[model samples]
Target chain A: MNPVLGRVFPGLEGRSLRAAAVVTVLGGLVGVIGGESVVLALVLALAGSLATLSLRGRPNPLAEEYGLLPAIAALGALAALATPSLLVGLLAGVAGLGLLLWNAESARDTVRTAEPVEGLLIPGLGLAIALLTALSLPTASAAVGAAAFAVVVALALVVWALQGALTADPYAAKAL
Target chain B: MSGGSADPGPLKFRPRAVALFGAAGALAVLALATHNAVPLFLALPLLLGPAAAATGAPRVPLSFRVTWSSEGSRGEVEITGRLTPSAAGPSAGVVPTFYRPEPLIDRAPPEVRSEAEGIAFRLHWSAPYPCLVSVARPMLHWRDPLGLVERPVRVEGDALRLQRFPPELARASRAPLRRTTPLPGEVRARQLGGAGEFFAIRPLAPSDTLRQVNWRATARAGRMLANDFRVERTGDLLIVLDLRPTSLGSEIDARLASVAAAGAYGLAQSFLDQKARVGLALYTDFVESIPLASGRRQRYRLLRALQAATPGETAGPSERLAVSLRRYFPPGVTTVLFSALADDESTLVLPHMRRRGFPAFVLSPSPVPLLGQLGPRPTEDDERALRLLRLVRRRRIAEAWSEAAVVEWDDYWSLSSLASFFARPAGRRAAS
Candidate 1:
């Protein structure tokens, strides 16, 4: 993350306060340039890059990890900043990012997490998929497609990261 | 077989699978809609590179047998294992890893070779102290050549429990000896001088190693004559080890312990080679002893005793040795004590052992020489005190030599010098 972000914003490591500023400004500029609604796509791209970069060393990087998450995160970020209802758009984006954060940290935490949450997660995912298909039906608005993409990719990544965390036995790999 | 290959499982996909297959699909969808070459350029190699590079992998279960290397010793052992991998499975992955359990002995990582027969390597556990060892072989990742696909497959290597033995026995010197032990052996006896290396040719007798019937002597005597030889007598030897904790610091403590163990085992091996009944007593927190015995089995017992240190029964008091000796060893056994004698209890136990009628000897590694190997004591005062304490211990050992045998080896001396104690008699030794 440090090296990649360094190429984007000189002298700013991923951990720096200014890196967040770079992400915000880049996300907002992409939205403003791509005619308003594209801001959500830009947000999804930025968010996806952050999440995947953070999970660099994990055994298997998922399809959503490299492709859909970044796209979804960029779209969500744009929606947060450019929507008429800024508060609602920000809430939706933050909620979606929160889910991604949980997925990212899943590789580190599994023992204390509830198993029932996963059971519930499956149904919640099914409903989200149904909602996504419905949104794509009204493909006249690109925002709807971006929102559905964001929801589907975020759900898929959550499961993928959790399963990966459970399977990767770091101690067993070295067999020390 | 000189070498062989094995496949434990099937070929599996990795992230490049995502990149090659998943990314390619996404790029195709995007390219179809936009007719864009930019995305194709960005995604093509990202997807194809890993899958292509990984022509495939070898997934094979591995099995191995552990044995002593041809060039290893009783005190320092080297181990070699024949590791054979099973045939390639549905998928190809790397073999399960073998690692060092602990740094008890310094060793390189297990070396591996995949050949027609199997994978052969020496485990990093080469020459670890003789004990019950613990090793783990877990399933490992098998990635394609391009690393586009990876799968976790079960490792089929055997989990082995090995009883480590001393490296190799050193030959005993054939010099005449005066042994008082009641055990039978190849040593020349003190009083029972019959049935040995030809003392004289007499009339035929029983219990003679054939070829003892001297045909020439019998022809001259006009009678069937047999050879008489000095009786080969086996003596009882008690090798005492002191593994008590000391103030010399843990590093030096470990060094001295190794020296003590090596010296004890070396001397024991020499004695055993001469067909002597050998016994071992480890004086640590408590006394661990292997009763008097001879032969290869006894050697194994002695090796096991050397490494059988329990946390509670180790790194503690030294005076416990006196009590152990009183209870365990008979009074007349030729007892040899191997210790640094850092504590008064150990040094003091020496004279008492001699007084009890044991032909007691001390093989102590003097601490003064090893001080140079140490970085420094925490303080100058501590350093001064350490040297002083060792000097006092040396004086006490020197005083005991008149009543008993003593071989004081300098810790930093060469192995040949230390080994001289076994090749020759002690500087001052007396029959008990």
Candidate 2:
């Protein structure tokens, strides 16, 4: 195994074969669920399958470390296709949201470990938006749900906008 | 006491503050619509925005750790760091930062824009959520990127102390005529005759007691030649290290000290290998002494002591070394003083010890060109400094004695130079 790839995705080389098998089964399931829309399901499943396979040989340890993000997205997308009911769609949406939150948390940990701060404003606001969106979606009407979703999307955009500004300066610690 | 001692079951997260502000804004808006009250709703975001921002903040728990290889070289060492988040909610997804502040011996600090591999995840959903994030880097240095706030964390680890010793003469080529004066309790070699102080006479050889042996002289010489031998016992050697702040400059001083310490350590090891007893003494004006002792254990102790020696303000050249030396060293033991010939105060006391017949070897670190790079100086100051340094060099040359050996180490190139110089068969034959 390439040292760089191994480093980027610890244990990924070993799991590549397993990941391929699981992805194949998941892809077939997606195709079965699409029914009349076989071509669309096949394409999405192929995209997800390729991502999973490509992650197996990612040459950067960080890329491998973050490989879970795409995997989670693919799984959520697959679940949404497999069961098109509102409940299943909601569950898939929640799962996708959970994966995104997980990705954000991982990114935050990477930042905090490298550079620590008293509080993180962007991520906090993002979490707030997610919580409010999730809670209001269940209790309120479609219009209210849409409003909450808009707020969540807006917060995500705000956080994304602040990424460059929030980048911790390497020499900032030495300033004091 | 009971009321005060009662536990506040895990801190509550209340939305009342947000609700109250929202209510007040709603009332203000209603009043505005009815034209009855002040417009307070305009302040809603100013008040509730920061409060909501504060509430949503992630409490990240950070710690630093440092580790190095056992080998004494400043090569690449793996740095492992972990950052754990203590809050759940959306805050658990935050990416923490890591960095190494000090420069490693072999490798320079990694490029500023480089990124590290890290994992962040929540361990549980409890009140204080613990999220763990781990990262590894070839060299230690990193930072965290959380918007609006940044924290710096440093990890302390084992620091490798790389040292190389001055080379010595090979044993095979070091042979020289052994000189000794025989006394009542001295060990003797069965040689035909000897020179120097007299010893008891035995029967003369066939080629012996003739012309220069007069009747009285022959009587004294008997049948044997009047042979003498000096006592051949290994002497105790004590190495004294002066760690005064004034003795060194900030940058090169520590390296100078380390070099001197390493030299003394190497020489002591050589002496021990030659069956000599070795001891060590470290002194500064404030810290009086680390007493001298002899043996393998003492050698290890001295190395450790040397490692711990730090320059301080209280120590200077004029400080009395005799008081400390007298307290720890045995009478008439050979003493080696390792110092940077920086101040005249230390030079003042050297004559007194020489007067006492102790062979004092002064090993001075040769000042190098690195000092010039440390800071800017006037051209006149540089010229004056060079002139003063030359005078000091002359003084050291003038002060050289039969019992003293002064060695100046100016560059890394000089170690092999000196070793080769001393190891020459010609020098050994000439000295003998």
Candidate 2 TM-score for chain A: 0.37
Angstrom error of the Cα, residue B113, model 2: value is 15
TM-scores of the models, in the order given: 0.51, 0.42
Q: Interface RMSD, candidate 1?
A: 19.0
What is the Å distance of residue A156 in model 2 from its true position?
14
Residue lDDT tens for model 1, B1-432 = 111233334555543244345544565466445543223322333333333323333323423333223234332434465534333333222343433343235344344444455444554334433333434443344443322345555545454434333332243223233455554454544333345655766778676556777888888989888777665765677878777767767766665665566556666777777676788887667777888877899987886666453223245444456657767767677677777766655566765666655556676776666664446446777677667767787786777666566656663223444345455654323322
**Across residues B14-94, which tens digit of lDDT does each residue of candidate 2 receive?**
232233344335544543454421122112221233233333332222333333222221222333223322222122223
What CAPRI grade goes to candidate 2?
A: incorrect
Q: Which stretches of candidate 2 lie over 4 Å from their true place?
A: A1-176, B1-67, B70-107, B110-159, B164-235, B245-255, B269-276, B286-296, B315-319, B368-370, B374-388, B401-403, B417-432
Instruction: For candidate 2, give the lDDT of residue B415.
Output: 51
Each model's chain A TM-score: 0.25, 0.37
